[model samples]
Structure formats: structure tokens, C-alpha cells
Target: MFAFCADPKTLEGAAWFACYLTSATHLAMYWSVLTVMLLLALAAPSALMFGFGGALMARSHIPPLAWVGKGYISMVRGVPDIVFFLFVPIAVDQGLEYLMHVTRCADWTEPVRRGADFVVCPQAKIPQSTAPAYVHDAYAFALALLAFALVFGAFAANTLKGAMEAVPRAQVETAEAYGMNRAQAFRRIILPQMWVYALPGLTNLWMILVKATPLLFLLGIQDIVYWARELGGSKTQVYAYPHPDWRVWYFLALLVFYLGLTWASERVFARVQNRLSVGQATAAGEALRKAGAA
Candidate 1:
């Protein structure tokens, strides 16, 4: 950024390093960090919503709805996540395209599936074939987000189902005795208490999600790992900055980044669990009350 950075080839040592770090590619790499953060920020809430819905579905009185919820959780838990990571995007993408094809390509007489290829009308293409780079990136990030949400949401559903079931039978009876209807009892007694039971499992899911960000590379997103590998790869004398393979150092930075994220997540979850445990009958609540008295 300095005036001397005008001619990077003439610079060496710290000056060369500073100019290199501030280059366009490096700036893109830095922005990719935010992309990871954006994914987490969006994915966490989306996954939670899906999980909540799934839990309620499984607990529903309707047999069909309960089957779907339990099936989703079972499918996720039974299968390896990488299978979903690889399959979900393709499935979702084609599903959208196929739906559009049926509507938009209704006049066309061509079959969508021939042999190994699945073809769709150009109009049915997501973002079309000629959209800007950012739109494509956004689309890919969205797919990755969906896959993460699906996998994590299934696990969350299981956690929440257990938590919901864990609410004491006596608690519900007591609420009913106090003239509370089923819905009122659920709102006042079940919903408020389930979090204390669910937090531990949910916290673990968050950490796994944090670590799982690296799998974005598999989903065609230019996440931090991709950038680190690209930037830290050795460049020859033909390039502006020639250096040895520094991927190890780049990966080390990623290590530090993930560690920091995990540590912060743990602290946040601990505080949440503590706050939720404040007045409950759980062991943790008792400990908190005793600590308060002391």
C-alpha cells in the first residue's frame, strides 16, 4: 500500500512481504475468511430452524409427519456425512433445474436424462450460464449452506427430541393441574426447560460444524483452505514473488484460526448452559445455586 510498493520486484525483506500480503490475490484470500464466517452465521440459524421443525415433526401426532422426521434423522445419522456433502448439492441443484425444466421447457421434446448426462434447458439454469462471478459464488455458497443445514439439522433433531422427551412427566401433569392446557403447558414448561438438556449436544454440533468448514472446498467454494493452498503454493522466478512451498505455514494459520473459533464457541456455550441451568432441578443448577449462596 505504500509508495515503495509501487515496484514490488525492486523491494526485498519485510517490504517485499508487506507488498505481497497486500496484493489483490491476498486480499481475496482475506475476504474468503469472511465467506467462511458468513456461511457459519447463516448456516447455524438455518440449521437450528430445520432441527426445531424436524423435532416437532417427529413429536407430532400424525404418523406420516412423525415418520418423515424420524426418517430424516435416521438417514443423516445412519449415513456418512461426506455422502450427503457430495450428493445433496447435486440433488438439490438438479431438483431445482428439473422443476424449472418441466415448467419452462414444456414445449421441448427432449428427455432430461439420456445416458450418464442430465441436461436442462438453458433458461432453467441456476443464475443462467452467463451470470456474473459473484452470483455464481453466492449460489455455490448457498448450496453448501443447505447441505450443512441438512446434516446438522438431523443431528439437532435427535438432540432436541431427546431433550423434549426428557421433560418430566410430573412437570406436564403439574402444569395441567394448574389449569394449563396442552399448548400452554408446552410453552411454559417444556420449551423453557429443553434447552438445558439440549445445549451440550448442540454445542458439540457447533464445534463439528466449525471444523467441517474445510469441507467447503469439496463443494466448489473458495474457502480459506483453498485460498491458503493457492496463495502459499510455491511460485517460480517468472512470477512477481518467487518463494518455496509455504503451504505448511498457511495451514498452520488455518489451525490457529479453527482453534480460536473452537475455543470461543466453547466459552460461549458454557456461559449459555450456566445461565440456562440457573433455577432448574438438574445437577448443574444445584451446583450454580450452591455457588451463588457461597
Candidate 2:
């Protein structure tokens, strides 16, 4: 911020606009791109872990565990992701508050739910009602992240399950014949080979995750889309940075941001696909084989 930015009123033209763009709020808005990226970074691996668990459970010899795994994978197919995105955080939050209420407010005889209201003792509040703004924001973010992980985890579970099955049956049999137990075969042989098959589905999931970042707004996080709508709205002369409606321009920038992300992800996944394909028995591997020989 320049000295001129101290008085946005005196400024004019691009300089005025530049100062406005660099304003504290706008800077925060700009940094929200990183928030989206951070969400993806955290959510992707977390979801993958959840997916791996689900896939493993799905393939379990035990009937109950197998049913749970299959149910986990099948849940997404019947339900819309947006519905999960909306419902999961509230469910988790209320579930936590309910548990806390039971543990911390046992003396209170009042009902936890009265009509449509969900009321809990102050001690049962997540981050507490008196907590700092940042604490509240962080709590909301954590819930959103969990929701993302659970929903995407289901998709990932399905993909990983198929990938596991796609690993040649003969290879698994050979591992078993070589004195390897089921777990050892999965770890040393099946798991390694499944990645090549899983990579395509995972890549698609990554792209879907990127697009879905905008839904963070629906979850009440002040993500990039939230800032775009906020900053693009008209500000009066009394405000530090007065501006006309610029939602179109702001959204165009978001479009560019997402396009760039998609392009970068494609390039990265291409490299990863190639790397995973090395020495595999697939079309990509065959191509790499001929090229290496040539």
C-alpha cells in the first residue's frame, strides 16, 4: 500500500483501483486461493486414507466388515455429493455437541433438542461461545475438511477396490504359492501393481476435488467464491474502497484461476501416469517399452 492508498478518495483511475485491489480485505481475498489449495492438500490424502480403509474393509473375509466397506462405497452412488457436503458437517458438529452435552452437562435436566432448536450448555459449545474468531473459523474449516474427506473417500474406495481386483489374479495366486500370506501379498505385490490402474481414477477424483472447492462457500467458509461475491458488491463512498458491481470480473478471475489449476493438475498427472506406467503390462507400458527399445 502506497501513501496515496491512505486516502482512496483522492485517488483516481487505475491507481485508485490498484489501491483498492491491494486493500487488506482484498489481500485476504487473494490469499484465499491458498486456502482452497490447502483444503485440497489436506483433504486429498485424508480422503485417500479413508478410501484405503474402506477398500480394505470391503475386501475383508469377514462378512460384517465387508458389508460396511461395500456400503461405504455404495453410499455415494445413491446420494448427491452436494447433499453430503451440506449434511455431514452439521451432523458431525451436532453429534460432537451432543456427546459433549451428555458428558459435560449431565446436571442440566433440559432437553437438548426442543422443537427445531438444538441447544446445548455453554460448556458443550465447540471452541466455546467466547472463543476467538479465528478459533470459530478453524473449527468450521475442520468440519468442512472432514466432510470433504468422507465423501471423496467413498469415491476413492470404489476406485481403489476395482484397482485391487484388477491386479492379475494369477499374480496373487503366485504370491500365495510363494509362502506369502494374504496381507503380505497385498503389501508386496497387489498393492504396488494396483496404483497404475488406480491412477486414472485418482486423477479424475483430483480434478473433481478442484472443481468442488467452490462449494466451500456453501459450507460457510469465506473461500475464494465468498470473497469474489463480497468484494464485487458495490461499496459506498464511506467505505475505504468504493467500487461498482464487479462480480463478473471477479468471477472471470476465478475462472482463470480454476483453468490454471486444471491445466497444472493435468500436466502433473500426466507425469505421474507415465511414472506409474513404467514396466507395467498396459498400453502405456507397452508404448514405453517400444520407445525404450527403439
Backbone collisions counted per model? 0, 0
Error of 2 at 244 (Å): 2.8
Model 2 lDDT per residue over 104-172, tens place: 999999998899999999999897989999899889999999999999999999999999999999999
* Per-residue accuracy of model 1 over 155-264 as CA lDDT, tens digit each: 99999999998989899999999999988998999999999999999999998898899899999988899999998999998987789999999999999999998888
Error of 2 at 150 (Å): 0.3
Total clashes in model 1, counting residue pairs 3 or more apart in sequence or in different chains: 0
RMSD of each: 1.3, 1.3
Give the Cα error of residue 144 in candidate 1, in Å. 0.9
Off by over 4 Å in 2: 236-238
